[model samples]
Target: MDQTEKNVQTLFSMGFLDIEDIKNALRISHNDLSEAVAILTNDQVRYGPYSSAGPAEDVEMKDVTSTALVPTAAPPPYNSLPDAKPCSPKPDYGNTAFPQTNLYELEQRVFVDQWSIPYKKDESLAKCLIAATSLAKEGNHP
Candidate 1:
């Protein structure tokens, strides 16, 4: 279906009253579906779908889902990490900028060695880590 028809259907699902009110909300919101819903549901808003008398007094005050009222943060402009797919010949192997990409493998090896390594490190660091791991196991950890 077209834009107007789709909007009307969405409003109807949310318990909004009348085609005129939906149309007015759609216009006010510039045809954004979330904005339209928010406009229709808002108690103080002019183009809302509530009856002239308004909502029932005895009805439970439940949390309403309205996207327009919530402030949304914009996504980051660029990704820092390279994309890698599973079972590929060389998944992100060319990315020398970020070498420690296979963190899972490193962690697995560390655990297998009784959590000795902790991270990918030089021989000196590895020796220190092994000593630290022993200390930790003996309750004199640092």
Candidate 2:
């Protein structure tokens, strides 16, 4: 391969094929620099949303506020639940599968809730599952 291509391959291997890096690598060949970058990108060997320069080393960020958050009242003591006996087992939501129907198919479904909420009139079980799974993944469960 050519010298410019070899330099590009080396830069890519080091994850340093950003536009500025490439420009520096081909400093002796100003005419070939643009064309080299285009070739690298088209081959998917190099990519760019390239920063003009990397993060500054001198500027260190810090949070001035202490982690001991000031509160209006002292919080309750930890594990404050009374030493009560374990409550009775939750009754089984016996063998009930949520409706597998689409949102528009209201006429085709009938919902019945015995132990847990089955289905709302306008909301499909699938929709609820989708919403619930997303919320749970995000740790925003109610």
Candidate 3:
């Protein structure tokens, strides 16, 4: 039902006195389970008359049922590859002009492959080179 009823039921199930005793404790302790427990324990009324007999038999039955469902076999071992090696850490290339140089080299290679442009024609390649350089500087690529 309500919170106080739940607290009374919990206290009753925890082997902590009878339903009447738990209710009285809950009432005296403002429905706080911890305070009610403390009150019951202080009065030397921790366990109910039927608590010892009922719970012990129930616990034994639960243990029997749980053990029956458990598997007795040992688990298999894990296999790992012999040739697997951890990768080396990458080198930090701090703010340098290496990327711009690499971009120029890649653009030259692409121009040579796609347009069949001879290496001697500087004037004709200048326009395409300028556009490629601008795009590479702006962190954009075709």
Candidate 4:
């Protein structure tokens, strides 16, 4: 709408008064800012107090300090529990899906877009692979 209509919303957003009351005030005061403000200010109790600028109803505060939060799941029984064992089938951290066979591809994947690499040691791994491959290709042992 127009600037006045926009300003009406802005006034309503100031955590005081309702749109209808603001509109009525603007209408009654012939669009005078000070007079409209005075109108809303004078008759606060008559409006039954608009809910803190938002469209939501007034929320009552409840005492939560004494109450312990309910747990999501019941604790497992101690008597029925199995003896704790070391984690079986440990993850193969060496195995990866990244370029490993080709040195050029590995170098490009490592150096070009290094940030996009998933693992922190991707560059180190790629560098090792490239070095091994270069040594192998050149018939040099190191």
lDDT of 2: 0.42
Against the correct fold, how does model 2 do in TM-score?
A: 0.18
> What ranges in model 1 sit over 4 Å off?
43-142
lDDT of 4 at 141: 66
lDDT of each: 0.52, 0.42, 0.51, 0.51
TM value for model 4: 0.28
Candidate that beats the other on TM-score, 1 or 2, i.e. the better one: 1
Please give the lDDT score at residue 23 for candidate 1.
Answer: 84
The sequence of per-residue lDDT tens digits that candidate 1 reaches over residues 1-142 is 9998898888888888788878877766668788777666764564334533244322223456663565555432222213322322323322223223344434544454233332324322333445555556668633
Model 1: number of clashes? 0
Model 1 TM: 0.30
Which lDDT value does model 3 have at 88? 21
Worst 10 residues of 2 by lDDT: 109-118
lDDT tens digits, residue span 11-103, model 2: 566565485557453552343655445543443334223322235312223465776755455333222323222322432223133333432
Whichever of 2 and 4 has more lDDT, that candidate is 4
TM, every model: 0.30, 0.18, 0.30, 0.28
Ranking by lDDT: 1, 3, 4, 2
Write model 4 residue lDDT over 1-142, tens digit each, in one string.
Answer: 8867976976787654688778876766567676667667764443334623234423233476999976555433322324322222432244333234334433444464222222223333444554566666667763
